[model samples]
Target: MIHTTPHYHRIACLCTEAVETLYLLGAEELVAGISGFTVYPPEARQQKPKISGFSSGKLEKILAVEPDLVVGYSSLQSDILKEVAEAGVDILHFNHHSVDGVLRMVRVLGSLTGRRHAAELLCEQLEGQISAARLESAARDAAGLPRPLVYFEEWHDPIISGIGWVGELIALAGGRDAFAELAGHARAKQRIVADPQTVIDRQPDLMVGSWCGKRFRPETVLERDGWQDVPAVRNAERGHIIEIKSADILAPGPTLITRGLPQLQALIRQWHEDRAG
Candidate 1:
């Protein structure tokens, strides 16, 4: 029995990033199920039933809810999404890594979820923020402040560069990504910096590490062999270790700038001031 309502009810979000985006689009009331990892809004988890956990979930339970829409992300959830699709449930699969891709997703999701006006408004607001970031970067350049080389670490075990979205943030913040060439790679395995010497050779002026879902150990990084000689370490320009949600930065959702890019810009400005003085 298809409901005649324009908005979807009993929506199941497979990723927290999409969950956050739905909230931002003012469609929170339509969500009936959410991922267990959702933490940004704080109220979503408390209010919504935990229907899925990442890649594995009871498809029967999801079907029991009679959801009209299910949103999933990345290659990890491909199997689960396929199962949901086979069950006659509509699904939106998002795998974007770049900023523009996220904006496009916002517009698309907005239109699909009966929030077209909200989507347009959100895009305009985020693009405005992006424009401001560019203006700020230009202003700093006009002031003769040199842009520093930045290396953003996503994982410390094997060392990973910023993904597409994070790499975009690094550039918007007025610094050149030391590993910008690797930014658009789809997998973390591909983004790994296997050799310590490679990073040492880059001589980044700042190092910002966000060890996905874990606290980044800044002190541990400071003690690495030969790392002490790096300009960032020598000048004490090491940036703060932020605890960013992978979903927020990596997801093709509303948080690309609202929650991810602005914070990155603030960090870069701080690092620049530290190097100047």
Candidate 2:
């Protein structure tokens, strides 16, 4: 008898982005629990037990699920992993950056869950989508249009530009990032644009703010005296208020290209039309 190894029965996803990726990778059946912050797929919240959130959560609830494997990401989840592993639960941790990293993660997750073929297929699709966006950007450039200067706000408290994959995605979207120097650094400390006048000096043509999980208030931006000098504000251009959930962009997964890149393309196209007029 050729014994095919049995697939893992119950899996817990502590990271919201991984939950979405796993669902797309044909491992939905194995998902026994998911993070409370998972909002992309409504089904996850509806069906899976709320075991984890952005930071800390009910470890006992995660333990109660009795997951054969628990997935985690970033340093934020390190403590949770230590507890879970000490308790004798299996875990598959992933932390990656750049577009290539995301593909690797999909493949790894697929292998761990016995869905290698599904992972390969998904990776191919994601790469193709990214290629399409790049081609679109090139086409826009060929038409003798200039790219807009972009400032992407990941946080507002100390004023930080995006870090890691988000910064990379901004470049791929055909816009020049005002804070590209801050890419690949830790999220909190990176791109501390402490001087509001520095933003005024840069004179960004477009300002895209995700503001993490909260709604990006354009009026708050407009209200600032230093910001009034920038073109995006004076024209009331309504600088694109992007609501990209942080988990997806920061995950270093296929969704960065799948979800993040396309949104960037759309914004670039909008900029092109605005500039032409």
Candidate 3:
């Protein structure tokens, strides 16, 4: 007789995306603990032991879970990863920042948990969605439709631009990223819009704000000094300024395609329709 099971039977997900991925792979039972910030499946919060936050976690509580492996994302969680690693537990930290990187994360995570086949299937679905969105954008372009210039704000006070994957999503959704040059920077500080006037000068046709878990205030953008002439601000009444929740877009997982992409597509489509009408 031959026996085959996942290499890591007891896993602790310190990021919401990993928890969401495990659940999507039907391996939720393997999850020993999850981050307090998880909210995607909703049931995950209700069922799993909340063990950590994005940048902080108690070593004692994490150790109490006795996880065979712990998974997290980015350098933001490096401190937590260090504590868990010193305690003789295994840790996988991902630092993906682009659409391709996101898909690769799904593939790698699927392989780690013995769900390679499921992950492949999920990837195929996501790829198909990406292709479909691209096709839609191409068709619009073929008809000589102008793509909207989009300004995606990850934060407000410092005026941070969206990340790489987000800029990719904007292009896929038939829009041009207002700050495409800044998107390549892995750190938020690097992507900061140094002067508010820079955004005014960009004259974006759409402004989308995620605000990293904070409530996005379109009025604030509209009220910014000398922003009255910005197309997005001027068209605020037509819904050009919008908010996509952080959980859907900020998390580099399936939700980016499943939830975030669709919203961008709709907003861009509406922008075209409004212009046509």
Candidate 4:
């Protein structure tokens, strides 16, 4: 008989992705606490004690939970994790910036929690989703469908480009990332577009805004100066400006493949049909 018991009995997840992954792995019962920002498994938000936010956490509250282990993500949580470590609690921090990295995270987390088999099955499911998306994109390409150049905005104020995983998923979903070169940068600051005019210069066929959990206003893109001539802006009236919720795309988890990628593929497919029409 295969052992499905998790090693960690009480885990505190300081990120939404970890919380979502735990739920997907059927390890939610092991989670003692979760980040206040966790919303994917709505039940998590309701049931789990909120222990931390992205960059801030009350160490005392975290300690109060008496977690056997703490899981967090990104350098943004380094300081918080460090504090937790100083308190003599074991912690694991993951900094995955691409699709492959995200997958690796799932596998590692599963192994650490003693749910290796479950994790492998989950990865296979996710990989299958990705393969299906790639095949769909290839079919479209073979049918002479033009892949739209997509400008994905992660932030509106500084005009940040999508991260590595987002760019890779865009390609899998039948669109070319307009800022693919910038997506490789690990830091969000490094992905910042220096000038708004650069976007106009790229002339992307579609503009997608996630805004890192903030509401994406398509009107904001349409109102940019000298953007009237840009293809994406000109086509704004025809649904070229899209908004994907950050929870679906920004979180480095299964949702990227399950929810985010499908949305991108559908949008790109619509773009192709609209252009062909």
Candidate 5:
């Protein structure tokens, strides 16, 4: 348990990650408000007033709550921060794009909320999980078993690769990302796959799609012209297309560490086992 927590008690968070982590670390008592998208800890919806959204917010609503600190993340929520700053409301914005970034973010949030010990414990647990996963995956790789080539689709129409954290998790899960370069990008736009043919050329052994919370339709992928030759598409009837829920793997928070990484590892391990047999 966090014995030494931060002093700022009236916290207003503009995203699910902050609220969920704060709540998880037993700092919920400090939260006076939360983002509209917060669905985890289901009771959070009942407890805190919602005041923000992607690229928009009711700054006055947030201000009315009398928050001492407004915690949020990403460039997407910057506009809201600017408005809050102008209104003289203190705000802290996190822009983490990698796996380590998420841990550091949680640590920082824990410290901010006076849950430093809890945050460090959580980070240590996450690092332990990561290390165990990497060691197991590395052992399998050393055995000369082919690591399945994975293509993670974050979007469909224009075809965007997964983010840095997702790419890092994919590697830890014993798969090679087909679009590793694009996955390095912190922004989604920068990860866009300009030519659809590039994906086709990579010929991924696994095609996982999570359309940023939108329902992913694997059938839509198979229907694409010229994608038939792609290994994942050619095996579509055999159900090669993997669907990870956005909440499971996309959120850059505790869920990603505790749930997302494990799920990805299971999928990749299953693929290897199937091929080995």
Candidate 6:
């Protein structure tokens, strides 16, 4: 796969994910179109023609681009891919649920874009950053720094806990996830917090909410019935309730490694230090 040459000249990205990663791999020249939701690097917006939204794309617009390679994420776009395929367009769909899966996606994109060398280098850099964070946690652990209990809310309504790589990110950031068991589930619904009181029961030391791009209002979290007793809510002086941008953490691409992981690491470190003081 590393040695194979890329046949695609005109490429279309069906989501923000592929668009960001592809640009990172230095494949910007190959892109003919990208999803409207892609905002990272800023230049992608100014350069590539927008062809898709979150789940679907403009078929006629895509056809106009005459892309030989079309890439996206999830089964949600299966129908779109089917129609695109029927129109003789090549499709590459990726669904990465874990950190390793995210790295694999990078390698796959590199191979697809004929930039294996660059991809390997990027992977090494990400691994090094994660290792540095883990090492810091290890040193702190040796010094009796306890891992903070973290609860990550992926959604606000009906409450969804962090999914897949999120739990892993929290751990790497030196926090124990309150709903670590649910991290294995790929779907958000599978990770749903059935009872709001479950969070109270878990007693997370830190509460981080992304709410998938919608503004994260701490008031909503604070307003939950009987939530006043929860340690995360009870603590006000130490930055108990935090918000991470959805674009930074939710996107399964280079941004997650570059932006998401660092934010998580900082918060976990801060949470620990706050209690230590």
> What is the lDDT of every predicted structure here?
0.80, 0.77, 0.92, 0.90, 0.85, 0.84
Report lDDT (Cα) of residue 70, candidate 5. 88
* lDDT digits (tens) for residues 94-199 of candidate 3: 9999899888988887888888888888899999999999999999999999999999999998999999999999999999999999999999999999999999
Of models 1 and 4, which has the larger lDDT? 4
Comparison by TM-score, 2 against 3, better one: 3
Model 3, C-alpha of 237: deviation from truth (Å):
0.7
Over the stretch 114-215, how does candidate 6's per-residue lDDT look in tens digits? 888889988999898889878987888899878889999999888999888888888888888899999888888899889888898888888888988688
Of the candidates numbered 1 and 5, which has the greater TM-score value?
5
Model 1 agreement with the true structure over 1-277: per-residue lDDT tens digits: 2222346666888888777777888888888788887776789989888888876777987777678999888998999899999999999998888888878888876777788888788889999999999999999999999887877888988998888877778788898889998988988999999898898999987777777777677788888989987877776534433445565564556676877777778777887777677
Give me the overall lDDT of model 4.
Answer: 0.90
True-structure RMSD, every candidate? 3.2, 2.7, 1.8, 1.2, 1.5, 2.1
> Stretches of candidate 4 above 4 Å error?
none
For residue 45, what is the lDDT in candidate 1?
84
Instruction: Give the least accurate 10-residue stretch of model 1, judged by summed lDDT.
Output: 1-10
**Best model number under lDDT:** 3
Best first by lDDT, ranked: 3, 4, 5, 6, 1, 2
* lDDT computed for candidate 5: 0.85
Which pairs of residues collide in candidate 2? none
Residue range with the least summed lDDT across 10 consecutive positions in model 3: 1-10
- Each prediction's TM-score against the native? 0.91, 0.91, 0.97, 0.97, 0.95, 0.95
Question: Total backbone clashes of model 5?
Answer: 3
Q: In what order do the candidates fall by TM-score, top score first?
A: 3, 4, 5, 6, 2, 1
Task: List ranges where model 5 is wrong by over 4 Å.
Answer: 237-239
Supply the TM-score for candidate 1: 0.91
Ten residues in sequence with the least summed lDDT for candidate 2: 1-10
Tens digit of per-residue lDDT, candidate 2, span 1-277? 2212436779899987677878887678788998887865679889888898867866798998889888898787888998899989987777775677778888887877777888888988988887877777788689867877878887888898877777667767888887888766765675788888888899987777777777777778888878888876775654353456554565456666877777777777777776666
Give the clashing pairs for model 3.
Answer: none
Q: Give one digit per residue, the lDDT tens place, for model 4 in 176-202.
A: 999999999989999999998899899
Please give the distance, in angstroms, between residue 170's alpha carbon in candidate 3 and its true position after superposition: 0.2
